[model samples]
Target chain A: MKVKKFLIGLADVFRFIKRFFKEVFYPPFEIKETLRQCFLLGNRSLFLILFTSFLAGIVFTKQSRPSLASFGAESWLPSLVSQAVVRSLGPLITGLICAGKLGSNIGAELASMQVSEQIDAMEVSGTRPYAYLVVSRVLATTLMLPLLVVFADIVALLGSYLMVNGINGTSFTLYFNEVSAVVTYLDIFSSLIKSAFFGFAIGIVGSYAGYHSEKGTTGVGKAANTAVVVSMIFIFVIDLASLQIINLFRVQ
Target chain B: MRTETDIIMPAPSQPRGNAVVEVRHVSKSFGDREVLVDFNLDLFERENLVILGKSGTGKSVAIKIMVGLLKPDSGTVNVLGYDVPTLSTKELNALRLQVGFSFQGSALYDSMTVRENLEFPLKRNLGIYNRSELDEKVMSALKDVGLESASNLSPAELSGGMKKRIGIARTLILNPKIMLYDEPTAGLDPVTSSEINELILSVRDKYNTSSIIITHDISCARETSDRIVGLFDGRNKVEGTFDELKKQNNEELKPFFNY
Candidate 1:
């Protein structure tokens, strides 16, 4: 039964993908409306992403200070911060940021639809509900998370850069050069790849939970909470697996 | 008691106009609880059939089954000649092209404006139309519901009655052959309820579309329904024209009549 249910879920994923392509590219692009959603999901999240990345960067720099000082390798701070910010922390942090915003929002929105029978209304209107709800969020997350992560990377690096400058004067040009030298295309690509998976997982899981919700108001709340928790856990798992794959190939 | 319209039998061999929906011996149960037991109904083209019953009597369940949102435990639901339970997803999509529904609470997308809500379906399903054509349809549907001025406003800004009207407008955008309404007049002021009833009747007349309405409002049911089917304990207890049901003062239907 468990295997059957798993296979059904896999099938549902493919079904959703098919609907997604149809709804997204078909002529009546809700481009203006979708852009509005993008702004809500991506642009509005900028400040929260910036604040969290700044604090995280500050803490990382402060903690790494004593360890690198012991080895007289404090100059490695720029490379270390840049690599961490760009590769792992940036995407993870940005995902978590969106998990709080987009995940919960999507859950609440869809849950309300389920609770109020709006989804059924869509189905009866000859409109595919999955195509409209799940696909829109998937596209939004796909486009938004990467953009948000880029913003986060810059904020985190700049935050860490400020911390390094406070401790010892390092020129921006020199610091950036060091960051570019240590971080390869592979590292950046791997991070981005993981973030996309994270985005997809977050959007789909959130939508699936909310769309299938049977409970009423309480159900909506529970769906929102569960979407974030489950997506966050999956994000970590995907992140680790991506890192492993990147490492495996790099070793060759 | 049933209405005069219910007494008029469906003409045999004659095309009942569009024959919008046909349900044959549909039975649905959730686990051991039989929500719908051997239910049968035929909705004619452009006819409004109100299903009246108390809560938990499977009125909503009946509509869900008809629309292919829920599969019947056994029996066939033939809408536009496509067997609902057996339809592939693509086929179901094609079948859905001819049906429309308005939920009890109007189920407007709260995040979107009335225009966006109306436009979402138009753009997705009828994507070939240019923006102007889409705009014309959206405006026309909103006008049909008397919500033309509220187009750009978000759903949150509309009154409950206006929301319901907007919901109807959204349903009309596709120009469906059949419309399913679940408690269209529930939870509204008496005046608003009457307005909705009038609007529903006017809509069917204008579009020549059949409707299956699940409702508890007796006045609304009597006013809007051509046929009234009474459901109790997942079974169709009594069905007749509104005048006929109203005339039968049987003990079994006494309580429903009092309301």
Candidate 2:
């Protein structure tokens, strides 16, 4: 069973790669349709990501202040907030948000299409259904996620800014300087890379489960649920592996 | 109803036809159970043949093998003269150019408009036609299936029959030389079934493309097929004009024809 599962995954990866290339050049580009999907899958979900980021930012800053103060490091508030937003929270929270929304939605949509025989129809029409359905959505997810992460990070910082000054008034310039001092290029790059992988994972897994879905309505729900859970697990696993690799380069 | 003689011997292969597709002693098994055992078929040019079988009789498997979607364990499938098992991905794709499939369910892309679905083949296979030409082709294909007014609609909005028609339209736009219909009207209402049957006949009459239809619906078989090939177990049970099968007073054949 394990061997069979592995082979299936390998075949699906190869199929998906082939599909992506085939679809990239299939004309009547459907730019308007793709943009509509981005709006539905990306933009519409921004409020949830933004709102969660804000609360997370506020909580992290407030919670860390007392601990830092214990070490006579209360002035590290801006630095701590900035590091949290850039290196960890931004991608993590945004990915979780997408895993819940877009992942489930994509899985359900594809599952229904499979159940309805739409995929087969495309195959018969001399169209590569994999290219038409999976590749476009995966590409959209890949391109839209980094931008969403950027938005989330910005909102998170804004929330942190409010929380930091709420308890003790601090000048905006001082806060800004302290935050910028701690946020290295590595922090930004690592988080961005992680989010892109997260996007890819979400799109591929969701489409796979949905595309191969059977058993009708129950199957649709199962695909959506599996996509969210599996992608979330992948996100955390990838994040941890990345952290260890990044740490390996420097002796802390 | 059309009698058995008219349905049994559909134009008898096709004038040497140069063997467009050949299923040579092909067999398939899933796990321990065998689905098809030593099945052989020859598909020639410009003929419409119907494969009839009960559910689970490997009708779909035969189509998959011919199309190179599934490889047979022990035989050769040659499509347009290219050896299927040995063909490169690019080569298989080239062969696919000559074949069109309408899956058991109408498989229109749920996310795309009917116009987009129809245009995809023209764009993919033909490449780079002007927008007006593409639009004209899409409209003509839709009109071929009596779905011209549904250009902007998505599959979700269309009924089961309409979706199937749109699917046929999409297949037509490709202008494939051979068409495969997998249970084309399995779940449709009776009225819709007749309409689809008419559509299938019209395709053969209008396009002159050789068609292989896999179906369990006897009505569809009786209506559109030039020759009905009965598939039982795995091998062909008996094949002749539909009228022959309908007239066979043999007790075994009686159950199949409900005599």
Candidate 3:
């Protein structure tokens, strides 16, 4: 019975995505609202992403230093950290953070609105709430998450450099030069591609849960929880799938 | 029994050309629980029809079905000459331009202020872009509701009565041809509830629009309705002028009228 319920939920999410695509290009583009969501999703989330990225890079580098030293490859620390952060960890951490922050926020906001009959009010007023509410937020997340990942990557590398300096006194310039050498365009592009999918997943799952929430106020809490859980899982799924695709491209 | 309209009730039901809203043998259900079974109503031009029913009697659901927000399992709901369930989303939205609904909770956009709340329907339904024009409409709506001082106040800041007024104002800004009120006075105090009832009456007289007001407040029904219908179980059990219904002893609607 639980498995049946899960499949039904999955099918509902697909239906939600289909409706999103159908309503996306209709008239009254809602340019202002979409931009407002971009500002909210991107600018508002910047500080948290930066702080997390910094911590991630510092911790990752500090832990890996001993392992590299045991292999007598301490000089290769910069390449390894940069490769790991740029290829996957940067986007993955950022995606998880967004899934927790933006995903939960969207879920709670829309769920409250739905329970209050605000969505129905909008629909009866001849304003397509689906287009104005869901599409704008979804589009913002899709377009902004990749940019946020790129920004997090730079900040994380800087944090990694500081850790390197603490232990071995490597200059910032040499550390960055090593990073640039190791992190290829493919490494950067593929993770960014993954971030976009992660953002898409978060937006859709959040909207679906909130929009269809039952059981009133308790349902709103459930919506927020489901949104974060589903989005976080999808981030890992996308990351794994992107790695395979990137490897195939490298082979080709 | 008084059969005439007065300061409290709206003017007597004026015989109109044709019905603007028509429902026939509508049946709806959620899971095993049936909400509306074989419910029917006809709303004529400029008539203020009040539907008096018990709680959990599917009053809101019937209203939602009329507007195409909820689909009935069986039966026809015709509004403004278009079959409601048959119309596409775009067409339904076009039809919605003429019909306004005031939610029980007001449902004012919590994110927007009073002025922006009124401006939303204008920007979406009519495509009004001129700053001064939008401002004029917004201000006029606020004035209509005697809330000009609250133009910048958010829905969160407003009192319950104020929110209900603003909700009605938001709908009024669109110049809707048909108005539906779902418990406009549900949570309000008697003083505020009567005030809202007067506003409903005044709106009908001012705009000459047909309306269906769903409420349990008998006094409110007395004030705003041109004709009152008693919805028992799932169908219209008794319907007449407020004065006429008051004179007769109705066993089924005894609780509603305090018989």
CA lDDT, every model vs. true structure? 0.82, 0.81, 0.90
lDDT (Cα) of model 1: 0.82
Residue runs of model 1 more than 4 Å from their true location after superposition? A1-37, B1-19, B128-132
Q: Per-residue alpha-carbon lDDT of model 1 for A94-176, expressed as tens digits?
A: 99878878888888889988998788777776676775677777777877887888778888888888888888988888888
Question: lDDT tens string, model 2, B56-168?
Answer: 88999899888777788888888778898887766777777778888877777777799888877787667845899999899899899998899999888999999889888
Query: Which numbered prediction scores highest in TM-score against the true structure?
Result: 3
Output DockQ, candidate 2. Answer: 0.52
Put down candidate 3 lDDT per residue, B7-108, tens digits, no spaces.
466776567658999999999999899888899999999898999998888888899999999999999999999899999998999999899999999999
Tell me the tens digit of each residue's lDDT in model 1 across B177-221. Answer: 888898998889877877888788888878878888898888777
How much does each candidate deviate at the interface, measured as C-alpha RMSD after superposition?
A: 1.4, 2.5, 0.7
- After TM-score superposition, the amount by which residue B71's alpha carbon in candidate 2 deviates from its true location, in angstroms, is 1.4
The docking quality of candidate 1, as DockQ, is 0.68
lDDT (Cα, 0-100) at B92 in candidate 1 = 87
TM-score of each: 0.88, 0.88, 0.97
Range of the 10 consecutive residues with the lowest summed lDDT in candidate 3 chain B? B1-10
Q: What DockQ do you compute for every candidate structure?
A: 0.68, 0.52, 0.88
Return the top candidate by lDDT: 3
